[model samples]
Target: MNFVCDRVAVTDAVGIVQKAVASRSTLPVLEGILIKASEGRVVLTGNDLEIGIECVIAADVSAPGKVVVNSNLFGTAVRKMTGDTITVKMLPNNAVSIKCGNSEIKLNGINAEEFPEIPKFETEFDIVLSQREFKSLIRHTIFAVGTNEAKLILTGCLLEASGNNVNMVAVDGFRLALKKVVTEESSVSGYFGDVSLVIPAKTLRELNNIIVDRDDKIIIKCSQKNVRFEFDNVVFTSRLLEGDFIEYKKIIPTEFKTKITADLKSLIEAVDRASIIITNEINKSPLIMKISGGEIRILCETGAGAVDEVVPVEMTGADIEIGFNNKYLLEALKAAEGDRVNLDFIGPINPCLITPYEGDDFKFIVLPVRLRTDVSMDV
Candidate 1:
């Protein structure tokens, strides 16, 4: 392919498409990027046989052609070029020449025929969401996705769209994170009666990186086997994990023995300070949160040292003392988007629930570490 394009535009498109480039693969062609020049545009595509991204950059195409070049080489060359515009020309024997300003480089590229084509889905989307809302949902719950791949289904977030709302749920056995948002936008097709899919956490995270603004709209459509997300000049698609996600809704507690609203920043700071004495992960100590006397005290003690700090809070219902993984508490606090957080507890043994102060925007259920009975272990 022969084309001349603005450097910024080409670089941006390259960066977006290269996100899907295979770092290590058995197939050599899959490690490269497919460049197709036609109809006044150059389409850059990268695929690892699972997730694929295609980005288009407008170019002055003198000849309609295609080539597969090393993603790393092409991206590095384009990034280093100081010229405002770049020209790419395909040569005999699959050799490609690139030039910009005083810089000239030649790269041996693979035959475009070897590049695998990304599977296609329907052109129309089933549902649309505000980019801001979609991104927020992913951030609020993506962290809890299970790390163990044996349970393939738990490695992805469960995306559910029903009625007037869209919900995202992720679980890692230790904790469950759920984020829900209401949208008034209607699907063009009346097909999505109830749609649920397990989308890989990596896919959702990469999708989040591509989205630039809240004003931009994201078009979402899914088939039995794959899910597609389209927005801006980018198209992202991923294969769905086949299995039923855990029935998380049924496990959330209905009532609580102790419920309290605490300043989010204060609690987070206290938790951070209390974790200082957790010397090692092998024998890490848990932080004890004692709620009473109009304050919550976070205490952590190990053979190395101890940390104790009190943060003022407002409590209702009853007094309670709960032990928790300091790391889990900090993660939930970091995910919380509001100034105040509401904590609901059934008992020391039951999981603790954290929510945004007012609305149902976010819900986090964290399993507690059993409190110690020995005097040396108890705070």
Candidate 2:
């Protein structure tokens, strides 16, 4: 392949496609990036079986051809070269030469025929969402996804589309985060039919990073086994998990014994400071929250020391005490937007629910740690 391209355009395309390159794989071709020059554009592709990314950039093509080169080496060379224009030419015997300014580098290229075929988005069940809104939704819920391989479905975030609304949910068994937003255009007729699908968290995160322009719109296409995201000049594809997602509504509580409303920033800071002490302990120390009489107190103790912070709250119903993992509380609080947060507690054993003051669209559920009173144990 022979093509001349600007440095900025090539760099951006290389960086995006590199996300799909496998760090360690049994097949050597999986580690390299496929470069195809055709018509008036150059396409860069990377894949690791589960996920694939392809980016196309405008290039002045002299010959139409394709080749595979080591991704790391090519990316490094292109980034360090000082010039506005870069020229790549394919030579005989599977070799490619890249020239820029006064420097030239020769890289061993593999036959493009050996590269795996990346899936294409053939069916059309498209949805349009602003880049900023979709990116924000992923940031709010992707953190709660489970990393344990045993729960394969939990490792992905659930995406459900209906009417003009879209919702993303992630759960790690201990905590759950749900983010919902209304799209400008409604193309949900075929996207979800009537239910949600589990999408791998890693794929959503990759999409978030690559989508840099806020005003741009993203086209999402879903099929029975895979989903595709197209934006700007890149295409992202991932295989969906093959299992039934948990009926999350059943686990959410319907009633609460106590409800406390407090500033989101204050609560987050209090839990963050408490986590410092709780995290130092050999055993996972639980942070205890006691709410009563217009005040909420947070406490944490460990081998090093203890910390207690009290914040005023608007309380209703009776007093309640709940223990939870400090890290989970911190993450949930961070996801919450707006000035005030509502904490709904159901007895001492049931999970606590956290939501923004006037929003039922976003909800967070956290499982409570078994208190010392429930089971006698040494501390």
Candidate 3:
């Protein structure tokens, strides 16, 4: 494509689309970015079969055409350019020339026709949410998405939109994270019901990185197999995972026998200190919490060392002792929005539910680690 574009704008667009470029693909074109110059604008697209990202930037299009250039080479060339504007042109024999100031770089370009097309969806529903809200939703829930390939469904987070509410749920067998928010707007075609999509966590994570925290709204369009996110001058599309997500609602316990209101920062700090004794993953130790009266005692004993700390809390119901993976509990606590949080415990073996002191915007369920009483083990 022949286009003269603002160097900064093109550099930003290249950086955004490069996230979707296939790092190691059998198809050479998939490793390159498709640039389409048309009518005063340049469109850049990157697709890796699973997720695709497109960015549009205003440019002076001298000759409207399209070309596929290596993403790394083109991006680096444009970013290092010292001029205010960059000139890109298609040369003979599928070669692309980039010029800025005195620097010129020529790259072998693949025919645009070889690049795979991003899926076009006949959208059945659309949900509108603020950039800040959507970004927060992904950050809160993505940590719990499963990494196991055997359970494919758990690898993605469930996205549900109904009424004016949007909910995201993720589970990794050991823990579950749920975040709900009120949407700016939601609409659907007559044939479709409320939007229910299991979006791959990886796609959402990438989208989160691109999204800025603003009051500006993001439009999400959902189809049968794919979902599209449109905001500003960018469009993001991803193939949805095919399978039934876990019924997370049923998995969350409604009743608890023990509840404690603890300072979120304090609890997190205590957990962090206790986990310091766990030097390696091979023999990692759990953070043990003994809650009673108005205080909670944190303890950890590992082959490396032992830690003992305390965090005062407001407790009710029966006192309980619980053990949990240090990382899991710390992540859940960090994801919480408020300063104080409530932790609900069913017993030592059951899951621990964490929620904010006030609103129900988020909920986290972390399963307790079972402590083994071995003769050689010390508490």
Residue-level lDDT tens digits of model 1 in 1-379: 7999998888888889888998777887888999999979999999988899999889999998999999988998999999999999999988889999888999999999999888886543366788887898899998889989898899999988877788999999999999988887653344748777889999988888888657688878788778888888888888878899999998788799888999999999889888888878997788998899788988888998888899998888788888999998899889998889999999888999999899888899999988766334666
TM-score of each: 0.95, 0.95, 0.96
The 0-to-1 C-alpha lDDT of every candidate, in the order given, reads 0.87, 0.86, 0.90
For candidate 2, write residues 6-125 as lDDT tens digits. 888888788999999997778888998999999899999999888899999999999999999888888988999999989999999778999999999999989999888888656547
Q: Considering lDDT, which of the candidate structures 2 and 3 is the better prediction for this target?
A: 3
Model 1, poorest ten-residue lDDT window? 185-194
Cα error of candidate 2 at position 251, Å? 1.9
Where model 1 places Cα greater than 4 Å from the true spot, the runs are 122-125, 374-379
lDDT of 3 by residue, 1-379 (tens): 5889999999999999999998877889999999999999999999988899999999999899998999988999999888999899999978999999888899999999988999997987787888998998899999999999999989999988877778899999999999999864553333346778899988998999899999888888888789999999999999999889998999899899999999999999999888888888876677888999899999998888889999999999998888889999989998998889999999888999999999999999999988775213554
Residue pairs of candidate 2 with colliding backbone atoms = none
Backbone clash pairs for candidate 1 read none
* Full ranking by lDDT: 3, 1, 2
* Candidate 2 CA-lDDT value: 0.86
